[model samples]
Target: MKKLLTAILIFISLFFFAQSRPEIGGNFIKSLFTDHNAEKAHTYFDSFVGSQISVNDLKELYPQIQGQMGNFKSILEVNNEKDTYYFYSDFEKSKLDIQITFNAENKIIGFYFIPHKTFDKADDKTALKIKSDDIELKGTLLQPTQGDQKKLVIFVHGSGPQDRDETIGENKPFKDIAEYLLKNGISSYRYDKRTYSNPETFNNQSTVEQETIIDAVNVAKYFKANESFKGYQIIILGHSQGAYVMPKIAEKAQVSKYIFMAGNARPLQEILIDQFEYIHKIEPSKISVEDIQNIKKQVEFLNSKKFSLDSPTSELPMGLSATYWKYLLDYKPLEAVKSIKTPMLFVQGGRDYQVTEKDFNLWKNQLKSNKSAEFKLYPSLNHLFIKGSGTPSPKDYEGKGNVDEIFLKDLVQFILK
Candidate 1:
């Protein structure tokens, strides 16, 4: 999942448009994704598109989406809200919602593609209950029904309120990874993130150490104390934000190995700035100078020593409290990893836009001398470890794809070693 800066970009857009025009907008979107022909779709944008974008640009963008979401299926639903029309369309691989804003003349003025969330049916057989203090968390454990488990891997989620499956749009990358590990004779556990299960428990005062780290430590302890897992080695597979804090968890828990997937070594506030700058550079037409300035102001507030839990959250990015940012700023993943002695595997996606190749290199440069640390980089993979072509946009995460099989193979070897 992306951090504050990226989430802000996802939810907000500027448009110089008027009332909804579903018929025109819907057909226009269909023509772009369904026909996968830029030349044919150009007519729809002729009068609407400004000098900032051209027909050839629209053509290139549409075909790139086809590469990610396959062919479009049909429009599932449509809603007219405010001055915009929202069309939810089914694609061969995933469901995507397109929002189109029109000018007073019924010409399209703005367009956006958003991933639609899909909930999976509950599986009772894999369900497990975990108790952390007064709170009980529902989780799932995946393992071969008839085989002895060689190792147990506990999945730690990235930022956000994630379910046990870490479901993103139509893809459940964690579930895919667990199933693959189970087939290879490994057992894995994943639970609904604390924030997802108990939102009321978290407030502006809550820090990552309190909200995330403590619960992860408890989960590890719970498994280590279980009689069923007595003979198996314990592994902590931390992804993104989870990976950033794995070393801290290792300090408090008894885990054999740590797998960092799309993890970052730099401070989160710094990474957030990097993400904003990168996106602004890539999509200059979409990102306004005012937007960039606003983000910079937020970054300045985050870096200020006077910032505290009581600071106004309205000015902060991602609607998170100053306390949360303070905690992240205080923690240094690279320094934490330096002190950790446990065997480590850092897995990175070369095409990941959120946590880019720069983070992976930081890890390598910091831990290269450590004999127990290893690294793997997949050039085509994104933050979720799903393979895709070209530069990975957030839309690519909506596509139906599994965690790369090659990563699973490597993970199996790491476990056995």
Candidate 2:
């Protein structure tokens, strides 16, 4: 998806103005995607947006999403909330929630594609809320129909503003994992990240602690205090970014065990550089040499003393503020893991470029002295723990794929054992 994928996490810095006309907003969105016209779409973007995103970026992103969701049908409805226009659009394969943020001049400044809200509740699933102080997060709890609810897996989201399902394009990895676990008599809970459920509180100055750990700690505490789950083992499972913060969550909560699914042991700044390099190697056309150098410069600047809380967010990678980078830079994941005595499992997908074998190896090697640490590696799976062949690129995240059965079996065994 070119730089668009890179810019997916980029924080918008502009002060937005409201637009009352859905027809005008609808027409702009139609022209942008109807023919997959990147050039035409680029014309609508705010001038400041040109630096971080390019027409080529839009060109690369459209096809990747379309490949997953199929061709766009039409905007079924539109809702304008202040500065953002939310379009409920129909695609061949699914309905999508399309959002566009406008500048004071009514030019497009931010664009995002989110899955339409669908609480696919069955008899085994029940809706719930996890309360943490003033913030309340909506969540889902799945209980096995035939077994004792003596154990519950608390799912912590990887990164970004993810829904409870952890929906990525057409794939819902968290939902798939939870549903499969229920079939095996395991209970689980998954919730929307604070950034997703309450963005105003999250703001742009959030750290990994505020973004992930606190909510996770609260979820664990909430369940641990519940009378129904008395004597039950509360296990926390972290995927991707969740893995990075798992140890801290475990330290603050009364969890029996923790899981690392494609977790990273390195700092996020380093991982960002590694990911950009990996993408550039596999799909050179999508990420240019200049793009690589630019990212490196941002990372380097972030590491330098010149970076302070007052530094411009626009100059930083992903437009994240200095506070966010500083928190991650100071976070020693290895040190964090070593401090926790709780039994842990490290699961890695060999094909996952985002959190590669290099990261898994770090966890295994460093924790080798800890008998409480266990490991599993699946050679054919991608970041989502889904199987794939050939070189895995950003394209792997597109389309439909379920978490591998073998991996799930092993996960269930670990939880039960």
Candidate 3:
């Protein structure tokens, strides 16, 4: 829950690539009506992509998407820190809303086809509701049936304000993980992120410090003390941004091993820059020189501790705060990882959107500093550790896919041993 968590509207899954051709007089641009120019949507977003037109140019030739998508739709937003253009399409009373993110130059980084059901609106039957930390967080706990002295695993989700199941598309990833682990005689706890759980409570507020890793830390401690978890070793499995917080949680929990799931290996600033640079390439044509310059200034301003509180950067996107940026910049997980001699297992999804190969490599580099680090990457897996490639999308889960069997097997073996 970044400072302004309540402002966003979530939906949709379709993604697209921008720019049909190389440059100025490309045949694709000349014939914009053709399907060849329109192109089939891509599943994953690529950074360093060139655009037919950069997103900045859109202000010059803007056609509001609001009439079609509804109010509160953003024509441009951030991906890793670069401004990307997004289009929303809500059709015929269907619950699904399609939101596509673009680069500052206006190329498509990816799309989120948000499923219709919101957490508040979702039926309770779909979730195993629980309360913790004096906040009524929604989540499901998996119990190992007929098992004695069961160890505990806690599930933590990434950057977004996500529900307990870590729901995306038609999939509830945490629920899937919980059920699978339970079937294998392991007990697990999964909970909705505070960002999503109590967005209104934090309405119009939150810089980076307001949300992020600390919630997961609190959640871990809450369950570890539960009567049901009386005699178990608490192991944490933090995926994506959750991974960013895992080491901290492990430090606080003083528990067993930790599962690093799709965590950011680089500093938050570096990752954000990389994400933006990637989008810059795709829509090179759509961007204006002035806009790029402004973005650069903004990123630099964001990274600066000397930045003024009154700066315009504070109002961007989710209103990401300077304090939050400072905190993230100051957060060094490896030091925490190094500090703890706890046994560690690393899980990397090969086709993740935000976490790239470089990120995993960085993790490897840092963790190797600790000889006790255990690492495994599933080449076919996406950010969620479910399998996919070419552009991982939520649809991957809706039709068919399983979290890598080996990842789970190895995890279970590690815990059991």
Candidate 4:
């Protein structure tokens, strides 16, 4: 997920260190993988890192590479881009790619372990256009060839500039979901995200309402106004960040039901902190004093009261504008859910690292007494609702997979009921 990668990049880029040195970057990465001692490796990597991830986070992630990929072999290739270095390496079990970004002083400010590659599969698709206010976007409408077109679903993507397929690398999860739904006598509508279609519009000031909610509202209205959809039961299916904001979307868009897939009840920034800590908990090791201090400083900034619409991007996480953070901080998904009277279904994956079971439990606990709400948990599924074995990693998304059949069935049942 490019959006996921961008978020991580933002988190790591906050540390401003020294200038780039190819030898320094290469040696630092080599030492981290070969040393076999996270503490010792931290000494080498920490000095290069300004402060983006906690030493604990690195410790947990470092070993997982060896655990999954086996011992590192040799660096197959290295590509340099400005102050950043991209290293392609071979492991006993598989290949891995690592990216390191450096500051002017040659210190490491960003590090990333990219997951495996994704491949695209061909599917039958129908072209469509979505219009709202001055925005007109391209999209696809997928449906079963023989069905009565009784049920219609709109897929709203997670954060970032996602296309109608919600494409990540070669994988198109939304397209897969839509096709699966079509096979089951359901119709779906998916469009290129507003940001993807019109990046210039968001160059200046923007809010969640402007960027996402309005577009969603327009989509629903378009479907409703069309005579072809007159008798269909309309559903809004949101994934990840999309799910997080669905409740708010419901406030403006009149729809038959809502589906929240891997959604979080907590604020976005708070969830990010939890995600960082989860990375650390999975692997425990001694961290350097400097790294610990850096993590503390970063957390302090997120928790401070100094943030406002006018706050500089440098003060915010990922250098996002103040307007963006202010909207996320002020908008509470769970609070919005409390006022929504529409029937809702929550689906969660047990192995999902991004939006974990904790978030699922939060929704369950909050909506427990509401008979209008239902929940489903897939213990073997990842964030994309794709079933897999072993501990789920970002690599799981690299392969071709469909939304769990049971999940699609449940979703169909919910829409018809």
Top model number, lDDT: 2
lDDT of 1 by residue, 239-291 (tens): 99999898899999868999999988887767777777777778765566777
Against the hidden true structure, what lDDT does model 3 obtain?
0.59
TM-score of each: 0.72, 0.79, 0.65, 0.68
Model 3, span 1-417: residue lDDT tens: 764454342212121123321221122222221222323222122444325444343332222432322233221211122342222222222224334444444444544444332333344543555554457766666675676447778887878777777765445667777777787788887776777657664433354435645556666677667786777878888888888767666666677778888888677666655555554555454445554555666666666665654545453323565455555666787667777787888878777756887877777887666777878877887766776666554335444355777777877877776
Q: In what order do the candidates fall by TM-score, top score first?
A: 2, 1, 4, 3
Better of 3 and 4 by lDDT: 4
| Candidate-wise lDDT, in order | 0.80, 0.84, 0.59, 0.76
User: Per-residue lDDT tens digits of candidate 2, residues 1-417?
Assistant: 878765654533222233344755676677667877778778778898866799899888878877767888899877666888778887877677888888777787888887654443444348887798678878999887798557899999988888898887668889999998888888899998888767788755778888899999999999998998888899999999999888788778858999999999987878989988988998998888898898899988988988888888877897888888878878788887898788899999999999999999999998999999999999999999999999999888766789999999998888988
Backbone clashes, candidate 1:
0
| C-alpha RMSD between model 3 and the true structure | 15.0
Regions of model 3 farther than 4 Å from truth: 1-134, 203-210, 280-295, 308-318, 391-401
